[model samples]
Target: MVTEKNNKGNQISRRSFLTGTATAAAGFMIVPRHVLGGKGYTAPSDKLRVAGIGVGGKGESDIAEFAKGPADITVLCDVHDSRAANSVKRFPKAKFYKDYREMLDKEHKNIDAVSVSTPDHSHAIQAMAAMQLGKHVYVQKPLTHDIYEARMLTEAAKKYKVVTQMGNQGASGDGVRQLMEWYNAGLIGDVKEVYCWTNRPVWPQGIPWPTTPAPVPSDLDWDLWLGTAPKKDYVNKLVPFNWRGWWDYGTGALGDMGCHIVEPPFRVLDLGYPESAEASVGSVYVDEFKQGYFPDSCPPSSHCILNFKGKKGKPDVKLHWMDGGIQPARPEELGPNERMGDGGNGAIFIGTKGKMMCGTYGISPTLLPTTRNKEVNVKQTIARVPEGHYVQWVNAAIAGYGKKEVSSPFEIAGPLTETLLMGNLAIRSYDVRKPKANGNGFDYPGRYIKLLWDGPNMKITNFDDANQFVKRTYREGWKLGS
Candidate 1:
């Protein structure tokens, strides 16, 4: 293995040295940037070289944010040229590629970090590739599409010893910290039940796949866009957006918003893997007599209950997750006119003493009765992210591993994402069908079943069929951690 010296003159393996050394040798004598000024100083040219995968939609905004820090946008890759046009115009000098794998193959040496904002299905493989090449990574929310992928990435982050951050920006916000302080001070007096709700699936859901296939767009590389997802024909309006409703490309409303909503309770309560999960989903009626259940698409609404064992002497906690315009009842202590959780998406904690609530991103924290919010005071226990979420990762990458602490490191984000996806497992299981006794129609076997979870083993103890979803089989040519 090739090795390089750090600021402390300690020899470290350079996994990408073969590719990177030639580029550096052609230019100038390559000196580790941290050694330039002093022990802790960063040089003027020591900007983090970044490559972005899926540079469209949220990917576009993520790269733009990274540019605001001490970083250089070195390369851009997107499956669709039209969606990437804005980012390409912004970074006119950056090299462009239609395939992320191709970009990583040739440009791994040129990049110190990678930003992944692709669809949920592709996040794990792309991030794994970057880590294998010894590159720091900043992945967007819902870290992976499946539980096994989340476990693999968490372990890989430690093995590779690289800086990692997940794009659940609220993890760095002050609101969650406030909730933590309040809980620590015994303000809410040990939360027993929690509620998180969102009005998502703002796009189409609870429907069938389009019967008519559309012509692939000239600017889009359909094959590359599919990535690790199973091969399928292109349908109109699936790109740019609306993929959130599909299982193959997306993980539905829970996957889309769970990270933001469930994160607060996870942090404040010190939660771990849920012991068991059960869900009841809303149905769409295709006709007056028949209710629709499409295996390919997510239900229009769902309510999942996840049970977690008590920690630090508190009683067991029950977490309720509701989506599709569903919400919890207003706290009796709250004033009738006062807003409850920003009117749409929010989280509420019910404790023995009182209740507390916050909106999406864990913003606008408040204690029940409205007056208590102003009356209660607690010292700030957690340090705030001064430069905000995007810059936190940028600075950490430049400082090297273990120097600066990031808010949503893979160690924490991975589990939180896994817990959220567990709710998805229950939602999908609720739709499982079998032949009816009378042979007239199908019976929903998974309904009303509380799937016992063996967290350490990553298996469903009660239901065997549900195990198939725990780890998805990638397309023949696409491999994870390749």
Candidate 2:
């Protein structure tokens, strides 16, 4: 993500040489992985020292995969001891801490890279803190909670000159490469529209916020787990998971599955920022014959349409996102017996000449009418990620910033995340309520209105209230930036 300029004579700046006499003399705190006394592999001392934050659930598996690469899992940090139990048991010798701030403050020198698999809310702050310390960072997908956080982290990666990879593993898969190859070969022609759908919120959503106070678990630090989110009473079933429904914490289904499903067309078409966004969200029933407007939680289902600006004589593309079990219409070319987009979650590209579809992680891609898949042969133009996503980051970190290429680097991921989050902004704005002058129920001006966006300015030009979702104010004691 970040590149260092070379010197005119040596072609080696402080970072380029990895670990030469000049690099050592420059006093760089973190050391890149360098081969030692081995022709094929690196010694233990030369392995990348990685510290993992949120070492639970996805975080647990993330570090485990990194360890399979050229990495040594040296430290594990988690707000909940119960969730991190498996990681701790596996990495018995690795240091453990409850606070990421304390871990980075005390052990930044000991670790060369940091892996963040925390909730969406805390991603920007934690990753930013690591990059500022000159640590190569691998952060989980939907990169950050808000659009501004995504933008900030993208800029910081370049400014800090650190290698960075987002956790959209599908971006590194052979499936996406295959899709790119077919599109590049004119098998899909020029895609004018795209559809990505998911059956998410397999957690609760479209409901009233829980008010009943729940006892905080003894093994968890409640305050630490609520990092960057607005503080309140601990609710039932809020921790470990299910927090994806809350606006104060999660980005709902878009943040949950967008990175995987959207990355295929995004890479295939080389998409940039969108020019506008609009959404239609499904409502919940608070009582018989009455619709509920729960701004605190995400809707049960939503369909968002984002219009991207065309370039170089190409027509503007409309990217559609559906979630909470909502899906686009099945293509007529396919038979009734054939499956549509892996049944529950998948994406479809509607092009001028033909259509193609893929399932989650961009797997099982095929052309329309099923039988055409065998007729069209696209050469493998892009190299495959043999080591997979997690290990790709490990290898890239070991090779130093801008040395080895990585899939879903911040340069590509930032705009993708902002594009997805734009849908969220539209959904949130749909609930923007104003009291009627007659003191009646309310008037919702934001509902059913297209939000013109200025991507460079990071604003919703037509709607002022919608801009609030672009950036959220952090709670006290938490800050993110240089």
The best candidate by lDDT is: 1
Instruction: Give the per-residue lDDT of model 2 (tens digit) for 1-482.
Output: 22222212222211121221122325545532352322112222368889999999999999999999989999999999999999999999999999999999999868888999999999999999998888889999889999999999999888877778899988887787778767767776788999999998799988888768899999989999888888898988888788999899999999899999998878777678899989988887756756766778888899999998765566789999999889888899979889988889999999998999999989999899789988887655556778888887887766566566677778888888999999898888843466544432234456589989999999999989889899999899788954
Q: Candidate 1: where are CA atoms >4 Å away?
A: 1-45, 430-443
- Of candidate 2, the 10-residue stretch with the lowest lDDT total is 12-21
Q: Rate the local accuracy (lDDT) of all candidates.
A: 0.84, 0.82
- What digit string (tens of lDDT, one per residue) describes model 1 on residues 1-482? 11112222322121101111222235565466545633223333589889999888899999999999999999999989999999999999999998888899999767888999999999999999999888899999899999999999999988887889999999888888778777777788879999999999798888878889999999998898898888999999998788889989898899999899899988788788999999998888877767777777888999999999986477999999999998999889888889999888999999999899999989999989789977887766456777888998897777666666677888889889889888888888733456444433334555579989999899998887778789999988999986
Runs off by more than 4 Å, candidate 2: 1-45, 430-444
Candidate 1 has its poorest 10 consecutive residues by lDDT at 12-21
| Residue pairs in candidate 2 whose N, alpha carbon or C atoms collide under 3 angstroms | none
Q: For candidate 2, report its TM-score.
A: 0.90
State every prediction's TM-score relative to the real structure. 0.90, 0.90
